[model samples]
Target: MIVVTTPTGQIGSQLVHRLLDQDKEVRVIVRDASRLEDTVRERVETVEGSHDEPGVLDEALPGAEALFWLVPPSRQAPSVREYYLGFARVGAAAVARHGVGHVVGVSSAGHGWPTPAGVLSAAFAMDAELGASGAAYRALSMPFYMENLLGQLDAIRGPGAFHLTCAGDLPLASIATRDIAGVAADLLTDLSWTGQRNLPVFGPDRLTPDGMAEVISQELGRPVTYRRMSMDDYASLLRSRGAGDQQVKDMTEAFAAQDHGIYDADWATAEPTSTDFRTWCREVLRPAADA
Candidate 1:
Protein backbone atom coordinates (compact mmCIF):
# COMPACT_ATOMS: atom_id res chain seq x y z
CA MET A 1 0.00 0.00 0.00
CA ILE A 2 1.12 3.56 -0.66
CA VAL A 3 0.53 6.28 1.93
CA VAL A 4 0.27 9.95 0.92
CA THR A 5 0.55 13.08 3.04
CA THR A 6 -1.39 16.30 2.36
CA PRO A 7 -3.76 14.49 0.02
CA THR A 8 -6.16 17.41 -0.22
CA GLY A 9 -3.54 19.73 -1.70
CA GLN A 10 -2.94 20.31 -5.42
CA ILE A 11 -0.13 17.82 -5.98
CA GLY A 12 -1.48 15.40 -3.42
CA SER A 13 -4.91 15.37 -5.03
CA GLN A 14 -3.42 14.61 -8.42
CA LEU A 15 -1.18 11.92 -6.95
CA VAL A 16 -4.17 10.20 -5.41
CA HIS A 17 -5.88 10.13 -8.79
CA ARG A 18 -2.83 8.61 -10.45
CA LEU A 19 -2.51 5.96 -7.77
CA LEU A 20 -6.16 5.03 -8.06
CA ASP A 21 -5.82 4.78 -11.84
CA GLN A 22 -3.15 2.13 -11.32
CA ASP A 23 -5.48 0.23 -8.92
CA LYS A 24 -2.94 0.57 -6.13
CA GLU A 25 -4.14 0.34 -2.56
CA VAL A 26 -3.69 3.91 -1.35
CA ARG A 27 -3.84 5.51 2.08
CA VAL A 28 -3.84 9.29 2.53
CA ILE A 29 -3.32 11.39 5.66
CA VAL A 30 -5.62 14.36 5.84
CA ARG A 31 -7.18 16.55 8.50
CA ASP A 32 -10.59 15.96 6.97
CA ALA A 33 -10.99 12.98 4.66
CA SER A 34 -14.61 13.89 3.94
CA ARG A 35 -13.41 17.00 2.16
CA LEU A 36 -12.02 14.84 -0.70
CA GLU A 37 -14.08 13.91 -3.71
CA ASP A 38 -16.26 10.81 -3.50
CA THR A 39 -14.08 9.03 -6.06
CA VAL A 40 -10.87 9.76 -4.15
CA ARG A 41 -12.44 8.76 -0.85
CA GLU A 42 -13.75 5.53 -2.31
CA ARG A 43 -10.43 4.61 -3.93
CA VAL A 44 -8.16 5.13 -0.92
CA GLU A 45 -8.06 4.57 2.81
CA THR A 46 -8.09 7.83 4.78
CA VAL A 47 -6.20 8.54 8.00
CA GLU A 48 -7.33 11.65 9.76
CA GLY A 49 -4.83 14.21 11.15
CA SER A 50 -2.27 16.89 10.36
CA HIS A 51 1.43 16.16 9.78
CA ASP A 52 2.27 18.28 12.84
CA GLU A 53 0.27 16.15 15.24
CA PRO A 54 2.45 14.01 17.46
CA GLY A 55 2.12 10.22 16.85
CA VAL A 56 -0.24 10.73 13.92
CA LEU A 57 2.31 9.80 11.26
CA ASP A 58 3.41 6.71 13.18
CA GLU A 59 -0.16 5.44 13.11
CA ALA A 60 -0.33 6.05 9.35
CA LEU A 61 3.09 4.65 8.35
CA PRO A 62 2.82 1.00 9.38
CA GLY A 63 2.18 -1.50 6.56
CA ALA A 64 2.57 1.14 3.83
CA GLU A 65 5.09 0.11 1.20
CA ALA A 66 5.81 3.63 -0.01
CA LEU A 67 5.09 7.14 1.28
CA PHE A 68 4.74 10.42 -0.57
CA TRP A 69 5.67 13.27 1.78
CA LEU A 70 5.25 17.04 1.59
CA VAL A 71 5.15 19.88 4.11
CA PRO A 72 2.43 22.29 3.08
CA PRO A 73 2.84 26.04 3.53
CA SER A 74 1.92 27.33 6.99
CA ARG A 75 1.59 30.84 8.38
CA GLN A 76 1.18 29.88 12.05
CA ALA A 77 4.72 28.59 12.60
CA PRO A 78 6.85 30.95 14.71
CA SER A 79 9.99 29.73 12.91
CA VAL A 80 9.47 28.06 9.56
CA ARG A 81 12.74 26.15 9.71
CA GLU A 82 12.06 24.77 13.14
CA TYR A 83 8.56 23.74 12.16
CA TYR A 84 9.78 22.05 8.97
CA LEU A 85 12.66 20.22 10.66
CA GLY A 86 10.37 19.07 13.43
CA PHE A 87 8.01 17.53 10.91
CA ALA A 88 10.98 16.03 9.09
CA ARG A 89 12.31 14.37 12.24
CA VAL A 90 8.89 12.98 13.09
CA GLY A 91 8.42 11.62 9.55
CA ALA A 92 11.88 10.08 9.59
CA ALA A 93 11.19 8.40 12.91
CA ALA A 94 7.88 7.07 11.65
CA VAL A 95 9.45 5.66 8.50
CA ALA A 96 12.24 4.03 10.48
CA ARG A 97 9.83 2.55 12.97
CA HIS A 98 7.51 1.18 10.32
CA GLY A 99 10.22 -0.03 7.94
CA VAL A 100 8.45 1.57 4.99
CA GLY A 101 10.09 0.39 1.79
CA HIS A 102 10.36 3.70 -0.08
CA VAL A 103 9.66 7.41 0.38
CA VAL A 104 9.15 9.95 -2.38
CA GLY A 105 9.22 13.47 -0.94
CA VAL A 106 8.28 16.68 -2.75
CA SER A 107 10.96 19.30 -2.18
CA SER A 108 12.02 22.51 -3.95
CA ALA A 109 14.75 23.18 -6.48
CA GLY A 110 18.18 24.36 -5.23
CA HIS A 111 17.87 22.37 -2.00
CA GLY A 112 21.31 21.02 -2.81
CA TRP A 113 22.75 24.53 -2.48
CA PRO A 114 24.70 24.98 0.73
CA THR A 115 23.79 28.64 1.07
CA PRO A 116 20.20 28.43 2.23
CA ALA A 117 17.36 30.51 0.81
CA GLY A 118 16.10 32.12 4.03
CA VAL A 119 12.64 30.88 5.11
CA LEU A 120 12.57 28.19 2.46
CA SER A 121 15.12 26.49 4.72
CA ALA A 122 12.51 23.75 5.23
CA ALA A 123 13.06 22.39 1.74
CA PHE A 124 16.72 21.80 2.48
CA ALA A 125 15.92 20.29 5.86
CA MET A 126 13.37 17.90 4.34
CA ASP A 127 15.91 16.70 1.80
CA ALA A 128 18.42 16.00 4.57
CA GLU A 129 16.04 13.98 6.76
CA LEU A 130 14.60 12.00 3.86
CA GLY A 131 18.15 11.17 2.75
CA ALA A 132 19.09 10.05 6.25
CA SER A 133 16.18 7.59 6.38
CA GLY A 134 17.39 4.11 5.44
CA ALA A 135 14.31 3.55 3.26
CA ALA A 136 14.41 3.88 -0.50
CA TYR A 137 13.93 7.61 -1.01
CA ARG A 138 13.46 9.88 -3.99
CA ALA A 139 13.61 13.61 -3.32
CA LEU A 140 11.71 15.20 -6.16
CA SER A 141 13.16 18.72 -6.44
CA MET A 142 10.86 21.06 -8.33
CA PRO A 143 10.87 24.66 -9.55
CA PHE A 144 8.12 27.16 -8.85
CA TYR A 145 4.62 26.01 -9.66
CA MET A 146 2.92 27.65 -12.62
CA GLU A 147 -0.07 27.90 -10.28
CA ASN A 148 1.86 30.49 -8.32
CA LEU A 149 0.77 32.79 -11.15
CA LEU A 150 -2.77 32.33 -9.83
CA GLY A 151 -2.02 35.34 -7.66
CA GLN A 152 -1.68 37.46 -10.81
CA LEU A 153 -4.95 36.24 -12.31
CA ASP A 154 -7.11 38.96 -10.71
CA ALA A 155 -5.04 41.70 -12.35
CA ILE A 156 -5.15 39.83 -15.67
CA ARG A 157 -8.94 39.81 -15.51
CA GLY A 158 -9.20 43.45 -14.38
CA PRO A 159 -8.00 46.90 -15.49
CA GLY A 160 -4.77 46.82 -13.48
CA ALA A 161 -1.26 45.42 -14.15
CA PHE A 162 0.26 42.14 -12.99
CA HIS A 163 3.00 42.84 -10.43
CA LEU A 164 6.06 40.97 -9.19
CA THR A 165 8.87 41.81 -6.80
CA CYS A 166 11.48 39.87 -8.73
CA ALA A 167 14.09 42.04 -10.50
CA GLY A 168 15.14 41.22 -14.05
CA ASP A 169 13.45 38.05 -15.39
CA LEU A 170 13.06 35.02 -13.14
CA PRO A 171 13.64 32.20 -15.62
CA LEU A 172 11.63 29.73 -13.56
CA ALA A 173 11.47 26.09 -14.50
CA SER A 174 7.76 26.33 -13.94
CA ILE A 175 6.01 22.95 -13.69
CA ALA A 176 2.48 21.74 -13.30
CA THR A 177 1.49 20.10 -10.03
CA ARG A 178 -0.15 17.31 -12.02
CA ASP A 179 3.15 16.45 -13.64
CA ILE A 180 4.92 16.26 -10.28
CA ALA A 181 2.22 13.96 -8.95
CA GLY A 182 2.45 11.77 -12.04
CA VAL A 183 6.18 11.34 -11.47
CA ALA A 184 5.55 10.43 -7.85
CA ALA A 185 2.99 7.86 -8.95
CA ASP A 186 5.47 6.40 -11.43
CA LEU A 187 8.13 6.08 -8.74
CA LEU A 188 5.68 4.41 -6.41
CA THR A 189 4.44 1.84 -8.93
CA ASP A 190 7.35 1.09 -11.26
CA LEU A 191 10.32 0.26 -9.13
CA SER A 192 11.58 -1.43 -5.99
CA TRP A 193 12.74 0.72 -3.10
CA THR A 194 16.30 2.02 -3.33
CA GLY A 195 18.38 4.46 -1.30
CA GLN A 196 17.98 8.24 -1.63
CA ARG A 197 18.08 9.94 -5.05
CA ASN A 198 17.46 13.64 -5.95
CA LEU A 199 15.33 14.14 -9.03
CA PRO A 200 14.70 17.55 -10.63
CA VAL A 201 11.30 17.73 -12.28
CA PHE A 202 11.63 20.68 -14.68
CA GLY A 203 9.01 21.40 -17.29
CA PRO A 204 9.92 21.40 -20.99
CA ASP A 205 10.19 25.20 -21.10
CA ARG A 206 11.56 27.99 -18.93
CA LEU A 207 9.47 31.13 -18.41
CA THR A 208 9.92 34.44 -16.64
CA PRO A 209 7.14 36.44 -14.93
CA ASP A 210 7.20 38.79 -17.94
CA GLY A 211 6.81 35.80 -20.21
CA MET A 212 3.84 34.73 -18.09
CA ALA A 213 2.20 38.13 -18.70
CA GLU A 214 2.36 37.34 -22.40
CA VAL A 215 0.65 33.99 -21.86
CA ILE A 216 -2.07 35.69 -19.82
CA SER A 217 -2.56 38.30 -22.54
CA GLN A 218 -3.02 35.64 -25.20
CA GLU A 219 -5.58 33.79 -23.11
CA LEU A 220 -7.50 36.81 -21.77
CA GLY A 221 -7.51 38.84 -25.04
CA ARG A 222 -5.90 41.81 -23.30
CA PRO A 223 -2.43 43.22 -22.95
CA VAL A 224 -1.12 42.43 -19.46
CA THR A 225 1.96 44.26 -18.27
CA TYR A 226 4.47 42.84 -15.81
CA ARG A 227 5.67 45.43 -13.33
CA ARG A 228 8.49 44.74 -10.92
CA MET A 229 8.19 46.15 -7.42
CA SER A 230 10.92 46.93 -4.92
CA MET A 231 11.41 44.33 -2.18
CA ASP A 232 10.39 46.79 0.55
CA ASP A 233 7.35 47.81 -1.45
CA TYR A 234 6.26 44.20 -1.87
CA ALA A 235 6.84 43.56 1.82
CA SER A 236 4.76 46.58 2.70
CA LEU A 237 1.95 45.38 0.45
CA LEU A 238 2.01 41.98 2.13
CA ARG A 239 1.90 43.69 5.54
CA SER A 240 -1.12 45.74 4.44
CA ARG A 241 -2.77 42.45 3.53
CA GLY A 242 -2.40 41.48 7.24
CA ALA A 243 0.79 39.42 7.00
CA GLY A 244 3.13 39.52 9.98
CA ASP A 245 6.50 41.25 9.70
CA GLN A 246 8.38 37.92 9.68
CA GLN A 247 6.23 36.53 6.88
CA VAL A 248 6.81 39.74 4.95
CA LYS A 249 10.56 39.46 5.53
CA ASP A 250 10.51 35.84 4.41
CA MET A 251 8.77 36.69 1.14
CA THR A 252 11.09 39.65 0.56
CA GLU A 253 14.19 37.55 1.07
CA ALA A 254 12.88 34.83 -1.26
CA PHE A 255 12.39 37.45 -3.99
CA ALA A 256 15.86 38.86 -3.36
CA ALA A 257 17.32 35.37 -3.73
CA GLN A 258 15.51 35.01 -7.05
CA ASP A 259 16.93 38.36 -8.24
CA HIS A 260 20.49 37.32 -7.44
CA GLY A 261 20.18 34.13 -9.58
CA ILE A 262 20.01 31.76 -6.63
CA TYR A 263 18.12 28.87 -8.28
CA ASP A 264 19.92 28.98 -11.63
CA ALA A 265 21.35 25.48 -11.41
CA ASP A 266 20.85 22.70 -13.95
CA TRP A 267 17.30 21.41 -13.66
CA ALA A 268 16.63 17.73 -14.15
CA THR A 269 14.52 16.75 -17.11
CA ALA A 270 11.11 15.39 -16.08
CA GLU A 271 8.53 13.37 -17.95
CA PRO A 272 6.48 15.38 -20.44
CA THR A 273 3.31 17.08 -19.23
CA SER A 274 0.23 17.33 -21.44
CA THR A 275 -1.10 20.40 -19.59
CA ASP A 276 1.26 23.28 -20.29
CA PHE A 277 0.56 26.87 -19.22
CA ARG A 278 -1.56 27.60 -22.30
CA THR A 279 -3.75 24.57 -21.70
CA TRP A 280 -3.89 25.34 -17.98
CA CYS A 281 -4.98 28.93 -18.66
CA ARG A 282 -7.66 27.85 -21.10
CA GLU A 283 -9.08 25.19 -18.80
CA VAL A 284 -8.51 26.58 -15.29
CA LEU A 285 -8.06 30.35 -15.50
CA ARG A 286 -10.79 31.09 -18.06
CA PRO A 287 -13.45 29.51 -15.86
CA ALA A 288 -12.07 31.39 -12.84
CA ALA A 289 -12.66 34.63 -14.80
CA ASP A 290 -16.42 33.93 -14.91
CA ALA A 291 -16.54 33.41 -11.15
Candidate 2:
Protein backbone atom coordinates (compact mmCIF):
# COMPACT_ATOMS: atom_id res chain seq x y z
CA MET A 1 0.00 0.00 0.00
CA ILE A 2 1.11 3.58 -0.76
CA VAL A 3 -0.07 6.51 1.37
CA VAL A 4 -0.72 10.07 0.17
CA THR A 5 -1.27 13.22 2.22
CA THR A 6 -3.21 16.30 1.12
CA PRO A 7 -4.87 14.10 -1.50
CA THR A 8 -7.37 16.78 -2.52
CA GLY A 9 -4.80 19.48 -3.20
CA GLN A 10 -3.78 20.46 -6.75
CA ILE A 11 -0.60 18.40 -6.70
CA GLY A 12 -1.84 15.55 -4.57
CA SER A 13 -5.03 15.09 -6.60
CA GLN A 14 -3.01 14.69 -9.74
CA LEU A 15 -0.54 12.34 -8.07
CA VAL A 16 -3.34 10.16 -6.76
CA HIS A 17 -4.82 9.78 -10.23
CA ARG A 18 -1.46 8.93 -11.74
CA LEU A 19 -0.84 6.26 -9.11
CA LEU A 20 -4.25 4.76 -9.76
CA ASP A 21 -3.50 4.64 -13.48
CA GLN A 22 -0.48 2.47 -12.70
CA ASP A 23 -2.65 0.03 -10.71
CA LYS A 24 -0.99 0.91 -7.43
CA GLU A 25 -2.82 0.19 -4.17
CA VAL A 26 -3.37 3.65 -2.70
CA ARG A 27 -4.56 5.10 0.61
CA VAL A 28 -5.02 8.78 1.44
CA ILE A 29 -5.25 10.84 4.64
CA VAL A 30 -7.63 13.75 4.14
CA ARG A 31 -9.66 16.14 6.24
CA ASP A 32 -12.85 15.43 4.26
CA ALA A 33 -13.21 12.20 2.36
CA SER A 34 -16.28 13.65 0.65
CA ARG A 35 -14.11 16.24 -1.05
CA LEU A 36 -12.46 13.54 -3.16
CA GLU A 37 -14.07 12.68 -6.48
CA ASP A 38 -16.66 9.92 -6.24
CA THR A 39 -14.59 7.65 -8.46
CA VAL A 40 -11.40 8.33 -6.53
CA ARG A 41 -13.10 7.86 -3.16
CA GLU A 42 -14.47 4.51 -4.25
CA ARG A 43 -11.09 3.29 -5.45
CA VAL A 44 -8.76 4.19 -2.57
CA GLU A 45 -8.77 3.45 1.16
CA THR A 46 -9.75 6.62 3.00
CA VAL A 47 -8.50 7.70 6.41
CA GLU A 48 -10.37 10.87 7.29
CA GLY A 49 -8.27 13.26 9.36
CA SER A 50 -5.47 15.81 9.08
CA HIS A 51 -2.13 14.12 8.29
CA ASP A 52 -0.42 16.36 10.85
CA GLU A 53 -2.30 14.51 13.56
CA PRO A 54 -0.44 11.50 14.97
CA GLY A 55 -3.51 9.28 15.14
CA VAL A 56 -4.23 9.78 11.45
CA LEU A 57 -0.81 8.54 10.34
CA ASP A 58 -0.82 5.76 12.89
CA GLU A 59 -3.99 4.50 11.23
CA ALA A 60 -2.83 5.06 7.62
CA LEU A 61 0.86 4.10 7.60
CA PRO A 62 0.89 0.50 8.79
CA GLY A 63 1.71 -1.97 5.98
CA ALA A 64 2.22 0.92 3.55
CA GLU A 65 5.16 0.47 1.19
CA ALA A 66 5.77 4.10 0.30
CA LEU A 67 4.36 7.52 1.35
CA PHE A 68 3.84 10.82 -0.42
CA TRP A 69 4.07 13.67 2.12
CA LEU A 70 3.06 17.32 1.83
CA VAL A 71 2.58 19.87 4.60
CA PRO A 72 -0.53 21.93 4.03
CA PRO A 73 -0.08 25.65 4.67
CA SER A 74 -1.32 27.21 7.92
CA ARG A 75 -1.63 30.99 7.93
CA GLN A 76 -2.74 31.12 11.57
CA ALA A 77 0.35 29.44 12.97
CA PRO A 78 2.50 31.51 15.35
CA SER A 79 5.77 30.57 13.65
CA VAL A 80 6.33 29.28 10.11
CA ARG A 81 9.23 27.03 11.08
CA GLU A 82 7.37 25.45 13.94
CA TYR A 83 4.27 24.91 11.81
CA TYR A 84 6.18 23.03 9.10
CA LEU A 85 8.44 21.19 11.50
CA GLY A 86 5.47 20.10 13.57
CA PHE A 87 4.04 18.20 10.59
CA ALA A 88 7.45 16.87 9.62
CA ARG A 89 8.19 15.58 13.11
CA VAL A 90 4.92 13.71 13.22
CA GLY A 91 5.50 12.25 9.75
CA ALA A 92 9.07 11.22 10.62
CA ALA A 93 7.96 9.33 13.70
CA ALA A 94 5.18 7.61 11.74
CA VAL A 95 7.57 6.54 8.97
CA ALA A 96 9.96 4.99 11.44
CA ARG A 97 7.18 3.25 13.35
CA HIS A 98 5.51 1.80 10.27
CA GLY A 99 8.77 0.70 8.64
CA VAL A 100 7.65 2.31 5.37
CA GLY A 101 10.30 1.69 2.73
CA HIS A 102 10.26 4.95 0.81
CA VAL A 103 9.09 8.55 1.34
CA VAL A 104 8.56 11.34 -1.18
CA GLY A 105 8.10 14.90 0.10
CA VAL A 106 7.24 18.22 -1.51
CA SER A 107 9.88 20.87 -0.81
CA SER A 108 11.46 24.09 -2.13
CA ALA A 109 14.84 24.48 -3.92
CA GLY A 110 16.91 26.70 -1.59
CA HIS A 111 18.90 23.99 0.20
CA GLY A 112 22.14 25.96 0.79
CA TRP A 113 20.87 29.48 0.27
CA PRO A 114 22.85 31.90 2.46
CA THR A 115 19.89 33.92 3.73
CA PRO A 116 16.65 33.09 5.49
CA ALA A 117 13.69 32.46 3.12
CA GLY A 118 10.69 32.49 5.39
CA VAL A 119 8.38 29.65 4.27
CA LEU A 120 11.01 28.25 1.93
CA SER A 121 13.46 28.00 4.81
CA ALA A 122 10.79 26.25 6.83
CA ALA A 123 10.34 23.64 4.07
CA PHE A 124 14.09 22.96 4.07
CA ALA A 125 13.94 22.38 7.80
CA MET A 126 11.10 19.92 7.24
CA ASP A 127 13.33 18.09 4.75
CA ALA A 128 16.06 17.73 7.37
CA GLU A 129 13.71 16.19 9.90
CA LEU A 130 12.22 13.78 7.38
CA GLY A 131 15.63 12.77 6.00
CA ALA A 132 16.70 11.60 9.43
CA SER A 133 13.89 9.05 9.39
CA GLY A 134 15.04 5.48 8.70
CA ALA A 135 12.98 5.29 5.49
CA ALA A 136 14.62 6.18 2.18
CA TYR A 137 13.56 9.76 1.35
CA ARG A 138 13.36 11.79 -1.82
CA ALA A 139 12.74 15.50 -1.43
CA LEU A 140 11.07 16.73 -4.63
CA SER A 141 12.66 20.19 -4.65
CA MET A 142 11.16 22.83 -6.93
CA PRO A 143 11.30 26.56 -7.61
CA PHE A 144 8.32 28.95 -8.00
CA TYR A 145 5.01 27.35 -8.89
CA MET A 146 3.47 28.80 -12.05
CA GLU A 147 -0.01 28.07 -10.68
CA ASN A 148 0.61 30.94 -8.26
CA LEU A 149 -0.56 33.16 -11.11
CA LEU A 150 -4.04 31.72 -10.74
CA GLY A 151 -4.33 33.70 -7.51
CA GLN A 152 -4.11 36.89 -9.59
CA LEU A 153 -6.69 35.80 -12.15
CA ASP A 154 -8.93 38.69 -11.22
CA ALA A 155 -6.16 41.18 -11.89
CA ILE A 156 -5.29 39.40 -15.12
CA ARG A 157 -8.87 39.77 -16.33
CA GLY A 158 -9.59 43.25 -14.97
CA PRO A 159 -6.35 45.15 -15.56
CA GLY A 160 -4.74 42.71 -18.01
CA ALA A 161 -1.71 42.41 -15.73
CA PHE A 162 -0.12 40.41 -12.92
CA HIS A 163 1.84 41.69 -9.90
CA LEU A 164 4.76 40.39 -7.82
CA THR A 165 7.25 41.74 -5.28
CA CYS A 166 10.29 40.45 -7.15
CA ALA A 167 12.16 42.37 -9.86
CA GLY A 168 10.46 42.21 -13.28
CA ASP A 169 13.76 41.63 -15.13
CA LEU A 170 15.29 38.88 -13.04
CA PRO A 171 14.90 35.40 -14.47
CA LEU A 172 12.45 33.32 -12.46
CA ALA A 173 12.47 29.51 -12.56
CA SER A 174 9.00 27.98 -12.34
CA ILE A 175 7.22 24.62 -12.80
CA ALA A 176 3.64 23.55 -13.20
CA THR A 177 2.19 21.58 -10.28
CA ARG A 178 1.14 18.81 -12.66
CA ASP A 179 4.78 18.21 -13.54
CA ILE A 180 5.74 18.06 -9.90
CA ALA A 181 2.97 15.53 -9.28
CA GLY A 182 4.16 13.46 -12.23
CA VAL A 183 7.67 13.28 -10.81
CA ALA A 184 6.38 12.33 -7.39
CA ALA A 185 4.15 9.60 -8.78
CA ASP A 186 7.09 8.11 -10.69
CA LEU A 187 9.33 8.15 -7.61
CA LEU A 188 6.69 6.70 -5.29
CA THR A 189 5.90 3.83 -7.64
CA ASP A 190 9.56 2.88 -8.18
CA LEU A 191 10.89 2.28 -4.67
CA SER A 192 14.09 0.55 -5.79
CA TRP A 193 16.15 3.70 -5.19
CA THR A 194 17.51 4.21 -1.68
CA GLY A 195 18.99 6.88 0.59
CA GLN A 196 18.08 10.57 0.93
CA ARG A 197 18.49 13.11 -1.86
CA ASN A 198 16.99 16.28 -3.36
CA LEU A 199 15.54 15.88 -6.87
CA PRO A 200 15.10 19.28 -8.59
CA VAL A 201 11.95 19.46 -10.71
CA PHE A 202 12.35 22.62 -12.80
CA GLY A 203 10.60 23.55 -16.03
CA PRO A 204 12.40 24.27 -19.28
CA ASP A 205 11.73 28.03 -19.40
CA ARG A 206 13.68 30.79 -17.68
CA LEU A 207 11.39 33.75 -18.18
CA THR A 208 11.44 37.01 -16.28
CA PRO A 209 8.13 38.46 -15.14
CA ASP A 210 8.24 40.94 -18.05
CA GLY A 211 8.75 38.11 -20.53
CA MET A 212 5.98 36.16 -18.84
CA ALA A 213 3.67 39.11 -19.38
CA GLU A 214 4.53 39.14 -23.08
CA VAL A 215 3.73 35.43 -23.35
CA ILE A 216 0.48 35.86 -21.46
CA SER A 217 -0.53 38.65 -23.79
CA GLN A 218 0.19 36.59 -26.87
CA GLU A 219 -1.49 33.47 -25.52
CA LEU A 220 -4.60 35.20 -24.19
CA GLY A 221 -4.81 37.57 -27.18
CA ARG A 222 -4.96 40.53 -24.79
CA PRO A 223 -2.44 43.14 -23.67
CA VAL A 224 -1.24 41.92 -20.29
CA THR A 225 1.58 43.55 -18.31
CA TYR A 226 3.76 42.92 -15.26
CA ARG A 227 3.57 45.18 -12.24
CA ARG A 228 6.31 45.12 -9.60
CA MET A 229 4.83 45.94 -6.23
CA SER A 230 6.93 47.18 -3.31
CA MET A 231 7.45 44.69 -0.49
CA ASP A 232 5.65 47.05 1.91
CA ASP A 233 2.65 47.35 -0.41
CA TYR A 234 2.56 43.58 -0.85
CA ALA A 235 2.56 43.10 2.92
CA SER A 236 -0.23 45.68 3.25
CA LEU A 237 -2.26 43.83 0.62
CA LEU A 238 -1.77 40.52 2.46
CA ARG A 239 -2.87 42.17 5.70
CA SER A 240 -5.94 43.61 4.00
CA ARG A 241 -6.79 40.09 2.80
CA GLY A 242 -6.68 38.74 6.41
CA ALA A 243 -3.20 37.23 6.59
CA GLY A 244 -1.80 37.19 10.13
CA ASP A 245 1.32 39.16 11.08
CA GLN A 246 3.50 36.05 11.03
CA GLN A 247 2.20 34.99 7.64
CA VAL A 248 2.75 38.45 6.22
CA LYS A 249 6.31 38.56 7.54
CA ASP A 250 7.13 35.07 6.27
CA MET A 251 5.72 35.78 2.79
CA THR A 252 7.66 39.04 2.56
CA GLU A 253 10.86 37.26 3.52
CA ALA A 254 10.21 34.48 0.98
CA PHE A 255 9.81 37.02 -1.80
CA ALA A 256 12.94 38.82 -0.70
CA ALA A 257 14.82 35.53 -0.86
CA GLN A 258 13.45 34.89 -4.33
CA ASP A 259 14.63 38.31 -5.49
CA HIS A 260 18.02 37.52 -3.96
CA GLY A 261 18.41 34.48 -6.26
CA ILE A 262 17.74 31.65 -3.81
CA TYR A 263 16.81 29.23 -6.61
CA ASP A 264 19.39 30.53 -9.12
CA ALA A 265 22.25 28.11 -8.49
CA ASP A 266 20.14 24.95 -8.45
CA TRP A 267 18.05 25.89 -11.46
CA ALA A 268 21.20 26.68 -13.42
CA THR A 269 22.50 23.11 -13.06
CA ALA A 270 19.36 20.94 -13.03
CA GLU A 271 17.73 19.14 -15.89
CA PRO A 272 14.53 20.94 -16.86
CA THR A 273 11.20 19.10 -16.73
CA SER A 274 8.90 18.59 -19.74
CA THR A 275 6.59 21.61 -19.42
CA ASP A 276 7.63 25.05 -20.65
CA PHE A 277 6.11 28.43 -19.69
CA ARG A 278 4.49 29.01 -23.08
CA THR A 279 2.90 25.56 -23.08
CA TRP A 280 1.70 26.03 -19.49
CA CYS A 281 0.27 29.45 -20.36
CA ARG A 282 -1.50 28.11 -23.40
CA GLU A 283 -2.76 24.95 -21.71
CA VAL A 284 -3.38 26.08 -18.12
CA LEU A 285 -3.46 29.87 -17.90
CA ARG A 286 -5.35 30.53 -21.13
CA PRO A 287 -8.24 28.26 -20.15
CA ALA A 288 -8.40 29.80 -16.67
CA ALA A 289 -8.31 33.32 -18.11
CA ASP A 290 -11.15 32.50 -20.50
CA ALA A 291 -13.25 31.08 -17.71
lDDT of 1 by residue, 95-182 (tens): 8888888999998767556554756566778778877877888888776677776777677678646777774376656678888998
RMSD of each: 2.0, 0.9
Candidate 2 lDDT at 255 equals 93
Q: After superposition, how far is residue 148 of candidate 1 from its true place, in Å?
A: 1.2
Provide the clash count, candidate 1.
0
lDDT of each: 0.78, 0.93
Candidates in order, TM-scores: namely 0.92, 0.98
Worst 10 residues of 2 by lDDT: 71-80
Using lDDT as the measure, the top candidate is: 2
lDDT of 1 at 72: 83
Candidate 2 local accuracy as lDDT?
0.93
Question: Candidate 1 — which pairs collide?
Answer: none
